[model samples]
Target: MSGALQPPSRSGVRIAGDLYQWLVAWHGCVTVLRDQTLRPANPIVAIGVEADGAGNLDDVIFYRAQPPNSYEQVKYAVDSATPVNEDYLLSPSPTGGPSILAKIAAAWRSLTASGSQVDLALVTNRHPDPGDPLIRDRDSRTQLLLPKAGVHGPRSDRGKARQRWAVGAGVSEQELLELLGVLRFDLGRDPQHLRELVQLLMLAAGLRYEDHAIDAGADWVARMVRDGYKTLSLDLIEKAVQDLDLKQGPARAVLSIATLKPDPVADQADWSLDWTDRFDGATAYSKRRPKAPATWAQLQADIEAAPMFLRGKTDIAVTGSLRQAPAFCTGAAFRMVSGADLAILQRGQVWSTSADYEAATPAIVEHSLGQGPDLAVAIAVATDPTTDILRYLRDQQLSVGSLLVLAPPAGGAKDNSIPDASTANALAVGIRDAVRETVRTAPHVHLFLAGPLGLALLLGHRWNRIRPTTVYEDVATADFYEPAFFIDA
Candidate 1:
């Protein structure tokens, strides 16, 4: 069966519209698998029919089956028919009437004789809901029936309704074969054509730049390049146009850009030659090649005015002679600079805030601090640490006396566990143990845990002997708070 299908106009309607067009274009191809006499041993007749339970075909069920029966005995002998065809006993039904069981039997026999299996598959955007009957007859005939009246109503959403529809369908073996044959024939043509149809629908719906278009362009370009078009030239352009039959404007531009070539003259001019004088006994000239070499100053004076000594301008000097010390030399020089010297140099350096060096100073200071043992042992985390926060701490240039910060993971929920009474007690014990270990190894060492509840817990305990300080959460964001430790002040 064939009919004109209309394109969808609504938003999100591209998929449906493209599917409809594909069914229409390949309507005749539904019989591809139906050719039994062929070597491949495919099916005979294929039909795609869709019903929405409202007595209307809402979709197409593509299938493959055998040819129509010719004799009455053949039809009657077919035992696996969904329903026994009684057309042999009775007169043929009116035109366009329901097919009798005998006809179905004949189709089955034809399929079996052809040595072809019934292949059936469904292609639907919406999935059938659970508990749907999805019924099929013994002969592989299928019909999707919607739920009876009042079974689904206004309360049901689109998803639920689709599920209900799927549950009501009944499919038979013969019908399934028919459905799949139709689908295989249609789908086997070319995936790109189906994609193009979908893209056209998307373009009509104002959904330009959809994945299909982007992918199609990329794939097409890749294929063209792989097909031996090394560079885009007039010959290549003409060949592409003749081979692909592409139109002159946009298509031509695409091919041209895909095979574009670099300028040969510009590439040749990128390198230059250099000239240098070699000293030796005899007068001679030697040429040496150099890449991107510099030009030498011209000898403006006349040749007659030039005086020739013992050594020739182009002679190669011996290695030992070249290593000899010069007749005249300069004095040896040395200078020492320290942190104070660097500070003086920094004072003299015209530091502009907009310059990159000015921005790098804090990083240099942090590097200096990080080199120390105390700061290296400090573990830190930020709730939502930012570059500015890190930069501020680094600017302090302090060798921190053991600090720890905690922050949430990226893109995670910010619901960090606040230390309760039990948690606080456990943390206090752990901190005490860590402090004792540090004291045994190196006395006067300070430990700090900075967080909202950590600070509160430490303050409540008044752990003066432990040398532990609790810093508030906002202290992390405060630029005025330096990283250095304070003693009792």
Candidate 2:
């Protein structure tokens, strides 16, 4: 039954390919826990599949002993049209000539014999259809496991597809109905939904760093699978809860990429920027950490001592605090008259921008630098206080074939600390629409996005729906922007 599975696509692949399997296992465990009859008794002895080599009976969430409380068979399909038919359950294997339905029947019999209620779930990435197969809606999915009855009698009498499986398993229609539950995941077409589900699983696993969440969650799933449980369920949860709950740590503050300076070791011949520094000097100032500048003069000394590089034309800004302040203190001001362009990156009085900087609203400026391979899209929000970067791109003749500028809407608040989600979403939608319109005419569009890191991440999350897009990190004094990562949608 598994041999016919097709390979996954090259693009739009999951970050860690098997995350879907782990998600299926987690959903099964969650389903069993939500069952009041089984949950209150604390009778769930273990929740895992039998690690016996065959890999037949998968996603087992056991309750109190001999038989499992729930048994789920997971299938992650790349195609949305894949069907869940009677043959999938009834087709016999060559060696033992036993079908999945027979195995499910045996499991139900064992559970019933042990006086435990049965909860069987068939989980798949595609929506199932047993009769008049389709992938559109829930109704079609319902028809897969439970066909509508005809007027003359029951649907089974009318030759419903599930009836064939019942006959093949030597079980009555009522018994089959009592044992089975259909759980479908339509993940193939909706990439955003899939990403959100994966993100939710990561959050449930207690990972807060959005960038690191998937990798960490994948590792958690891997540990569960490695320790003899072919599934991730309540057993893994119990373990996560036991070890002083190492999985649950205090969330670390998310530092913006702008808060750190880039590596100073670039060759004079190379103009490319690179962000290889380990610490955010901006954050260091706010926390009053040792070696943090306590005054504007000290900060100036630090900046003067800091390495500077010649750039082709990328505008730069320094963001963060000058001294240790209370968590809520936002009115402190810090400024330094330096030979190089320097600005303190903070909200309120700590505010400073490249000399005589004025905020500009949402506008798109396209430069025709001839038909070159390079395309640059600079995104500037009002909060970042560096919209001048757009102007810089507008002026530069860096063989950039086209330039797309995203600025705040007119009369919008500029230099706000954190851009609100609603505004961010609206801005992202506008930008996505603009990019779609632009890409139709301007193919092979490369990106040189500059904005708050939070907005960068949000853009990354949404733009993953687009083609392979590169994100660049601003290296303060570097000649050119650094290519940080690519979003291969």
Candidate 3:
């Protein structure tokens, strides 16, 4: 919780106070047009100009700011050579010339001022199919009109062939400059004697297409830099540098890792039983009654009195070593159970230390299953302990249908801490082997691992055939929910 959460700054751009005021005013108009419906088609046009040698101004790109119909038409024009009517033009001025009225008119034309042409088009339709006709290739030509130069052929004033296109009729220089200003501001430029400002207007408003905007801004800056526009005011550059440095801050946190276990009673259920009449009957003797109230001891005693049907059932025994006893005990004692029933057979006898648990688990499992309990569902819990026990269990040549070994969680108790990669790999290999062995003998034997460690243990081993049908969240708060869980199918 000690990480820096810096708000975006706007320390990019250098201009006179009056020009700044004009920019602010123009931006207001741009914002209004971008947010609200005004023009039915081509409400706004963003123009970018790249002047080339011979003052030819080779690049003149125009984007439709709003309305699906216009956006599509403009996109078609840019992507292909599709001719779009003048009415659909978003460019503030088609002539590539300056005009205060034109800028004002253009400002009044749109709402959100900053966005890519593609993003603006997408706004009109989300979830467009990838194979849609709009995405298909089309045969067309790309062209841009330039100012008419001196007459080339003879009969300059006599007969002449009408040109198919006209220059300075589709875009203007003023619109281009305004767009460049917007791009520079977005890329972090600042004025003198003020805190560096990184424009977060788009982010603040929860706008999308951030990558598109950044890319476009970078492209424009690179173009400007290449074109000898490197005389940026020192103050503006300094402010931008300062703003970036401040944004790249540091973080702090109190971090620790811990392992955990599931509740023994629920997890160790010999047979899965639903909470229904049958279960109630089996556990009825211990239920508190109006005539004969029962105590905790009575309830436990009643549960033991009920006949267990685990006799002759196929058994899968899982075993492992524990590196830490108290941690393992804390995890196992409190771990929640699912799809199984757990009951503490002898709480007083269960050891809560690594060495003791390792020494006692086998005997506890063996002793608890009096008369062999027909089959054993053993889960071995371990914390960075030697795999010698795992190897020994494997060497016993127990049928795969009767063995499952899982690794302990990496962290002792802290959240988001998983087992290390190496430990996870070893556990996975062990689990896979166990699963294969089990399936070979008892094909229908259901297999499961306890924690993330357990899951990784199996997965790392590539036991693709043994997938967990359910997961047990011992610490609900610490388990990260997959995004798919929240997605509506």
The candidate that achieves the highest lDDT relative to the unseen native structure: 2
Ranking by TM-score: 2, 3, 1
Q: Candidate 3 lDDT (Cα, whole model)?
A: 0.25
* lDDT by residue for model 2 (168-248), tens: 777886666555443222223233334444333232233332434444444565577877655445556545535423344
- Candidate 1: lDDT of 282? 20
RMSD of each: 32.2, 21.1, 26.1
Per-residue error for 306 in candidate 2, Å, reads: 53
Model 3, span 120-146: residue lDDT tens:
111111122223221111111101111
Q: Per-residue lDDT of 203-224 in model 1, one digit per residue for the tens?
A: 2112232443334433433444
Q: Model 2 scores what on Cα lDDT? A: 0.42
lDDT per model vs. reference: 0.25, 0.42, 0.25
Answer with 2 or 3, whichever has the higher lDDT: 2
Model 3 stretches astray by more than 4 angstroms: 1-405, 408-423, 437-443, 448-450, 453-461, 464-489
Positional deviation of residue 158's Cα in model 3 after best superposition, in angstroms: 66
Pick by lDDT: 1 or 3, better one: 1
Q: What is the lDDT of residue 244 in candidate 2?
A: 28
